[model samples]
Target: MKKQKIFALILPVIALGGLLTLNALKADPPSKSKPAVAGLTVPTGFDINVIADKLGSARHLVITPQNDIYVHMASTRVSKGIVVLHEEGGKTTIKTSFANYGGTGIAMGGGYLYASDKSGVFRYKLDANNQVTNPENPDRIVTGLVSVDWHQPKAITLDNDGNVYVNIGAPSNICDELDKNRTGCPLLDSAAGIWQFRTDKLNQSYKEGVHYAWGLRNVVGITWNQQLNQLFVMQHGRDNLHQMHPKLFTEKQSAELPAECMFAIKKGDNAGWPYVYYDWQKQKNMLGPEYGGDGVKPADAKYINPVVGFPGHLAPDGLLFYTGNQFPERYKNGAFIAFHGSWNRAPEPQAGYFVVFQPFKNGKPDGKWEVFADGFAGTEELKAQGRAEHRPTGLAQGPDGSLYITDDNKGTIYKVTYKK
Candidate 1:
């Protein structure tokens, strides 16, 4: 009996050892049974390839001139919130992983690589090759940003001058105050907008930053248009229009009423939130139900309008302006947006699991937006059920003009190249 018990315990331990060895051998596991690019659809003459796989919550990424790719994760499980990749010959592999914190929004500017966690932005010194030399000891450029419950990721961008903008998202859905009457949304005093700070300043608090714009509920995708010399941002629209006010909006109307907007931002600009939402169907901004409009009343004219509006709840997460010569002339200076897909369009099929291209001319949108890449959800049924195998989360352009996309679901990285 003593030998029998000892044998059983050894058997279980042996099995566990085998399992761990197997997992260790398979460092890069496939996300699905199907090939990574099996269902992907891109425009003609453009082909897509999976450069890396199984990255784990890859959020935003930036590519250096030397072709080194740095991907940020929402968590630290896989790469400890940051993964640096390098490609040699035909294979791309993780060169190293660093950073103790993970969130989103990474960019390269002013000879430094800037990355943000939920509460602050940090920067690492780059060497002559544009590679981070001091990942272990990054400088805390800006600190003390607000983050509570919802809309907390501090998506960041930098301007040509010396300014860095960080998005301080609001915590409320509509600032409803639990259905109680309120005069004004006090949350707007500190959140729901973008704040600008000097890049040269280190360890700056929220009090030292200046409010660049106000009343923008949450902005994740922000960029500076080099062609136009203007700042652009993608605003996540409010939700639960029908559930909050069923008498005013039907389920279908709620699913498609408020449009996700792209705004050309300027100092003092206010894309009204908790008070109005842009109705793409009506081509007008409508008053929010929380702020005393039944759905048909137009919002006050003082509220600025978006440069372009898209279907609601699509969740625009990344934006990049293409200035690469690798593509045809038609793509020059166009905007590429990655929609992270939606989860809230219940009672209706969820939409937006692809990347889109918006044509631009003379520093403004000149044509309608078109689907540039698709098949991210894996299947039609999966998309309808809001179960995505992989969702595009961030975009970066290589020095050679190749476009790189990151998937947050499975940590997949895709590279798109144009061939004539």
Candidate 2:
């Protein structure tokens, strides 16, 4: 009977795959609106400004040395692909819009703008003026990436060593029980964790110098921490906490069991997913169900532990390490993470619709974290109505040491700065 049910589910997915051929589509241009500037109350010296609004699903952004902004806007019901915004004279001009290719990640390094589509990673050279004069041409840096339902975002970041790290999310919620009441582990035989590739190569497969770290579930936010000189990622935790194993978790436990994690990654390190999790309140490591122990204590000494843990399912989409002198000195060398908010913790009011700051000292967290910015949810009435004006997805720093944040749900980008 279980086999029959599994077969029934597989048939629809196969049919859908046949029906919808994957192709890049052009995204709609930004809607015209008054250049709006709304201020957000931060610390005693900081100021926030609304830079651009009414964009269509703005996901990630990277600023060039010239201060031009290249924003990756996801296609919506009417539009298809990527858009580049050039900033000049206190105004943003649409430099180019490519309707042919689409993906969620974008980065700029080595005088080239790199983007990832459903198929693979591509790179294009930007002129000194920060314009992509050549759109028809892009070097396929990495190819053969899977773009299925579960692990499709393909968030990426580049290290100073010219290595591009891409997160290939796990395709399963705990790998689907082998049998009812049984737990499964990560499938490292295929796509499950972070894969590294050289930025200069084209169409390079994962089998090259591309394997970095393993056992991460979905590390959407990846950045090279300049202060630490290491790779850091914010991981989305596994879901269906209590429903998967009723014997181990209650509904409340499932809703708030595992924590969304911030991991400091090194080559060949395994921050165990489907096997271990960092318990925040308890301030210790805990075993996952797949390896046999209850969700109480750390299971293995071999797995790497997360540097910090957050509330579960807040959907951390962007992370940035502060290196500017604009804000207070305490913000220097600290990290900023944008939580896109919760979708699964339904019966209980959802959480994490804000940005958080974690101070760093000598490549490690110095003390407790704090909410750096809030009120993106708009109003309590709106939240009760199941509607939010924005969901923060991306983070970027401007040339003048100001910070910018993008919201995917409402298609807006905000610039945060300091006044005193």
Please give the CA lDDT of all the candidate structures: 0.83, 0.72
- Candidate 1, 1-420: lDDT as tens digits: 011100000001011223222133234544433366455888877877777776678888999887788998998766576778776455665666678988998988888989999898999888898888898999998898887868888899999998899999999888886347756788887899999988888998778899999889898888989988888999999999999899999999889868999999999998888888999988898889888898889999999999899999999999999999998899999999999999988888999989999999988889799999888888799999999898998999999899998999977788888887
Sliding window of 10 residues with minimal summed lDDT for model 2 = 5-14
Per-model TM values vs. the true structure? 0.92, 0.87
Residue 52, model 1: lDDT of 76
Model 1 spans with C-alpha error above 4 angstroms: 1-34
Q: Report lDDT (Cα) of residue 289, candidate 2.
A: 69
